[model samples]
Target: MMRSRLTNAPARLFSTAVVSAPKPAATRPSSDKGGGGGSGRDTLGRRLLSLTYAKRSAVITINKWKEEGHTVRKYELNRIVKELRKFKRYKHALEICEWMKVQEDIVLQQGDYAVHLDLISKVRGMSSAEKFFEDLPDKNKNRHACTSLLHTYVQNNESSKAEALMQKMSECGFLINTLPYNTMLSFYISNGQLDKVPQLIQDLKMNTSPDIFTYNLILTACLPQRDVETAEKTLLEIQKAEIEPDWVTYSTLTSLYIKNSLPEKAAATVKEMEKRIARKNRPAYSSLIGLHAKLGNLDEISRIWEKMKSSFVKMSDTEYACMISSLLKHEKSEEAMNLYEEWKSVSTSGNPRIPNLFLADYIKRDQMEEAENFYNKMVESDIKPCYTTWEILTWGYLKQKKSDKVLECFKKALGSVKKWIPEGRITKEVFRNLEEEGDIEAAEQLLVTIGKAGHLSTEIYNSLLRTYASANKMPLIIAERMEKDKIEMNDETKKLIELTSKMCVSEVPTCIS
Candidate 1:
């Protein structure tokens, strides 16, 4: 059953492959030895990184670089591929790797092959990546390449393939470290195969040593079940095994403590987590701010926010969003707005994520006027409002009993979303309001919008029927429309059809009195 659920899960669970291969150090081409190209020309790597994620080819760029009489070093090309992978430009990364395969001067190592296989998995799919792995020369099918394919299998939720590969790796003596085991553990946790986790951990202990990452995965598996007892035991085991508990370990424990309502333990764990925070680790700082927010430690949040601001020359939108969200959780809107302004000044792209936060706060407080103004201001500033923004506006109008505005906002929301199913509650409220007002045209328009979203249900059609019944108007095309939409008729539909059939257009009033 759990395996069934995993089978139905979507592919590409990870944006990038999870492998233990560290990036090679950056090395400039020897051509850059004399005062940076002398004509202010960019390096091959720089030109490659500058290419957009559109339908462009990295091979074309490489050819152009070679035409400029520049030497294309293998190390520089590898660095650029890594950078492209970092930015999630999988398509271009694969192109570059494919180009490297044909260059006489370029010879790919085992690690390069691993990276290539990983990129193929991301750009193409699991099947293509499997073929690439199978076609690799016998000498190139080393530990790294095998591990890379295992990552692809695990991420794609191909449990059988991953298990078979793991067995093969073990037979080949490739399971020398905890990397492959850790990958499987991650897959188990994500797939909700918790019962399999402990057994896997046991296997790791018996077959190979469990590293800190392995222990971290074990602790993470304990989270959804709120198994605090197991988490504490694992922490102790980490200490006994002499594996240093990193900030991630303590951050996770702090969350567990908070979830179990042990605030004191959480607070103490937070201190330990902070103790392990590296000066340049922004993620750790964010974790600290988030944990402090959960503990309602506003003072600690402020202290950590200041520390983070001082540590980095520039803060990312994510960092600002985290702080603003934390402040908002404590009802500190003033501080949140200030941070939003600071973000706006520095933000290059007019991302609507930060603006939606304030909009949500305003709507929650029944401040529709402020919400409308804020939405308009965001649009004026060229920030495209996402579905959440429109959904917020729709709910606000629903609360005010403005059916017209509610319909307008719902249409806008539908336009922005690619595939969205209307929530039953909001759908009920919107159609009910329109039905009560006898707005048959609005009801039909809303029905068509929802039908286009591909979520038309029996109840949704019934809402339109109810609007027809309230208006005492016969819908002549009801049967044809239901058949076209493939909605099966039920008791309610039969009753409404019978009722409308008896209502004569000559006898009924043309308009509601």
Candidate 2:
């Protein structure tokens, strides 16, 4: 793999034609039979055309010309497919290849074979791609194919199979290149097969002496398991090899220190990272915020935020949200509210209240009215609230024992998540809660409203049964409701209903019945 002389010169050579004369348009008349005229083909063509420029149309026209008995050279097709592949037009490219395979007297060169295998592998047909490799002529079995195949297996979580193939390649007198070896080592590290690192390192060192990437992989593998002593040893080995650690190395060390509850070490690593790198980066700041937040050092987090406010490494929405949430978590409600108002005033593009951090802060202080006002402001600004926000508001109102506000919040939440939830469960839970508070008429009205909406779940039926059992005078109404709703009670729910019925008859009913 590390021969003084490069053997596979063709792999580096520009085999693809850099400049080719464009073929004249096909002379044959257009026909719907072989072209994309059917529903499936039309759909494919439409999607292809939707991309920027009419690139998809070029692909379809090229394929159409070939289907209509017009001569199309391999170079022409390769050029179009290459462009399409760059745009992630995988499905379209695959369709073109499948069509080409059926034509007469067409030979796919090694480059075409490699590209086809890559496209297929991306579409999750690695087994089919492997079969394609097996069918390749001896001359085509080069480093590119082997490396790509190994990567495919690794991506698909078939590391054992990838290892077998690597061993087979070596047995056949094919030298395993650094590319494949590095990929395999990284795979081993990612999958927690750290125990195998010694053998891998020995093999590489004896053969090619493992590059910077190989050492970094070994170091990261040590970090995740909190083997800090081993990590330090690996860093020393890296320095002995005269290979300086890169951002990945520094970031991994910082993350490991933070994970092990050593914030001071993590912070020191960040300082080293800043000295090593030419410019500041986001990861260092993110790690700082995370470490400080973990240590409950809000003052340090705030200082970092201030330092990064106008830095090149800008704060992302989630990062800003995290800072506000941290302030709230530490009972700095006034500071959180002040920051929220400041962000709102400075945000020129959109509504700042869409994020839940402000709502969370208000709820932390048991200020339901303020939270509700913020929610209303969000609605008035035409910013669509996510399901999470609705869920938070619903639960928050329930905690405050504000039944009317809970009802309003539930209605708002239902508008967003109703289609995704079991209709019966929402209706049953709402009605059951209402009836438990002695609002039987309101519960029945809500039941009628949700029944008009859509299908309900069995949990909703159970809630209705519980509500009726609690009333002690609605047993017949419960049976009628279940029958009318066409709800098939599961065995467990049926047992509960039976047990509740017996209890309701023998004693004063409870709200949970």
Candidate 3:
């Protein structure tokens, strides 16, 4: 249960003011200005839409209206402020907030003050929020501004201020709802002053109906209390409160059992957890599966797997991946492979980790044929292989002495990753594989694939240059290609180039010599 710092807004803002019927000078919709008495609503909307991050953007547009004897309506200014916050341009959001305070036409509401305090708390710190709150005209202190102050105290760990303000709120009857109470509960939880929790919760139960979160906090406090007995008492107390125990309560209990090495109790808690929530809870299910795996209850793991697949819950790649890992743990590789195939057939997106898990198991068994078949199947299914997937294949094929297949897997893996973030140092693995065989054709094919994908990096290109140099082939063309790609020459490039020159004269691989 989270609390918002802003007060609830009115049903509408800037209602049309009354006027004598003879003149018919009345407000209208924002779209139709209806000739003059300038409000600058149009300019506010236009400036926000421009989406410029420049300092003068919002201020300059509003100031022009101010210079010409026009001011933006309160509602229009609020809309721009909200839009800037939504775009995550907090500086502009505060700028719009500040600009609204000066406009004669914009009469700031409590909600406006609420917005300002929250923004100040967000962009600046709680110190600024306290100062702003202090400076507020006493009329602005509503439930929102007051709670925000309590939150500010909570944020900065001003325990004394928070308790005082919380006392003030309780006396003023601002604690009518559970939100403020939950905030205080969270504060106690974060600060680890849980001895104060039971008393606070007892008071909460007497004055206000404690929700599930309040009970969950009590449950969380059990582990630190160093006894499962506390959790059980808390659960009974929760049921006594007529509050239904949710998955969180059960999950916490299950975690408690796991923490104390109580597998049977943990399993019972997971079963109860499964019974409570009607829909698919992936995290809970995965946790149960993992706990069972850790206990070596293969039969239980299998039953849970079947239960998960039959349920209405859509399985994620992680769920499938975890299942694959569990099966591997239990030496059920064939079953894991079949499950991977079935999962891949209906899956909408590909996850590299799943296949990599399968590939590792295959390589460990020296089942190169199966690994090759698996790789081809993944490619045919359009599930792209990442570096780990390709690396294992490279190692497998090199072990089988098929240098071409090693480079083939390397190109496919490198070509698959289209994201702009540089891939990690798997290029070293590829260089080692190619370097051993000294196969120029494989290196040439890899360089061609790299160029087409436009994934050039110093390590990747240098790996190839080193391969050429070790094999006594001049890599002048690779240097030229690096220049064309605008990749700057690093020390590795220079060292490889100089080594290649020496190799051209000596005509032997360095490792051989």
Candidate 4:
């Protein structure tokens, strides 16, 4: 069952007192009655019970009963309506409420009237709820009843309606409390209407002094907007007004500082939280870990992780993955591997990121077989290898002159454009190695492949052109191809082309020889 926020009223008010009203005894109906008695009541009673325990079945039953000639009383109808509203069955609730409205001589008590208004408010039919409230007899407009109507408007995001109700309550000599004001302020903040916050605070200062929740509400609103300067000023004002900052206040400040890229300040706030409250919350540890990682302070990250581990902080899978990757980045692969092994041992629930990090470590150590094994393991675990993983495997195959494997990996890399690919020195080395091994055909094919893929550079083009020229076959043809491809040639390249053309002409021996 979903708990209602409104149900936090004092226990004394909520307790049900047994009434002394007389119970009506069951009597056998006359045989001439048009509707059957025992069977009909039993079916209706079963449907009513289903409304509480089995909602869908209950809806089907209720509709079936209504379709038949059964007359559902206002009290019984209201019970179903209340259940529907609680379950967020707005359409059904509306249908039932409209049906109830048409029945004559059905006088609803104050509590039932409030429930109707609440349903109307929840459905965001404010005009309907307003009309209902206005039609109610003046004698029934008690403080609690008016407050319920006010909260209905608030829940519907209709602050102006709630304010009008508050004014009416004040006119009726009801002592207006901070609840409505806090609610309105929260609405304004949640909707990103920060300009309304100061005015609300001013109104509370002039009329009823603001409470801690009021200040906290303002701070919570300000945090996400990155309005830390205003939040800080508000904190000082809160302190001057004798309101002590709670855990929520500090947490908001920590998060705000982190958002503004002030990790040092965020860390300081976390320290303050640690000292001010002996017991810490989950967010505090999360903030610390995030801040330390952002600062590139792996030592501090390790310290915080150790503390969290000892204190039994429930680290999320993402946090665990980040820690492992950080360790691998710092070349503490042994420690990372140990942690990965431990995590695998304890965690029945699998995460792909851990294996991905392990695969990265294997690539870094030039352990291609081990890396391929991890990739296979990832596939077995139903974890799809990301594009970076494929890029790593591609480079590994290229280094080992595995042309078929290279082609396979290249396709995978191209599938995801955002993943990293080798550039500059490493790419030059791949081409150079291919050319030296007398695999000019494969090397030229790769050049065209990379050029089509937009990864080939002028240096790579020049290197391939020089190799072809040295072979003394189709130097002019290759040069013309480079020109047609719009690849820029430097001084050395121009001179090489001229010299190769002359060498090709001279190598054809004269007829006298």
Which number leads on TM-score? 1
lDDT of 2: 0.62
C-alpha lDDT of candidate 3 relative to the true structure: 0.70
Q: What would the per-residue lDDT of candidate 4 be over residues 1-513, giving only the tens digit for each residue? A: 111122223212210011111222122222212122354455454454334332345445655887998766676666656555555655555555655565575666666666766667656576666666666666655555566666776676665555555554444444345766787788777777777777666655654677878877877887768888888988898889888777667767777787888878887876665555433465566555654555567888798788777877456666677778777777777888788777776666576667877776776688889888878877886666766676677778776777667756765666556544655655565666555553445556666667666665567766765555655533436565677778778887777666666654322112112
What residue runs in model 4 are displaced by over 4 Å at the alpha carbon? 1-156, 159-175, 221-229, 256-265, 276-284, 291-513
**Per-model TM values vs. the true structure:** 0.81, 0.54, 0.45, 0.41
Q: Candidate 3: which pairs clash?
A: none
Q: How many residue-pair clashes does candidate 2 contain?
A: 1
Q: TM-score-based ranking, best first?
A: 1, 2, 3, 4
- lDDT by residue for model 2 (71-121), tens: 666554555466566567676666567666666777776556667777788
lDDT tens per residue, model 3, 1-513: 112223343312111111001220111133312222245555556655454544556677677766888755666677767666665666666778888887776678777877787778877987688778777765676657777777776776777667766655555555666666777878887778886776677656555787898778778877765579989888898888888898778878888888888988888887777677555455777767776776678988889888887884567888888888998988898899898888877787787788888788888889988887887877787777777787788778767767777777766666556643444555566566677666655665666666667666787778777778767876545567778888889998888887776655433333222
Query: Residue 131 deviation, candidate 3, in Å?
Result: 28
Q: lDDT per model, in order? A: 0.81, 0.62, 0.70, 0.63
* Model 1: lDDT to the true structure: 0.81
Maximum-lDDT candidate: 1
Q: In model 4, what is the error at residue 361, expressed in angstroms?
A: 16
Candidate 1 at residue 25, lDDT? 21
Candidate 3 residue runs with Cα over 4 Å from true position = 1-283, 309-321, 337-360, 374-395, 398-401, 417-422, 472-474, 477-482, 505-513
- The CA root-mean-square deviation of candidate 2, after full C-alpha superposition on the true structure, stands at 12.4
lDDT of 4 at 51: 42
Clashing residue pairs found in predicted model 4: none
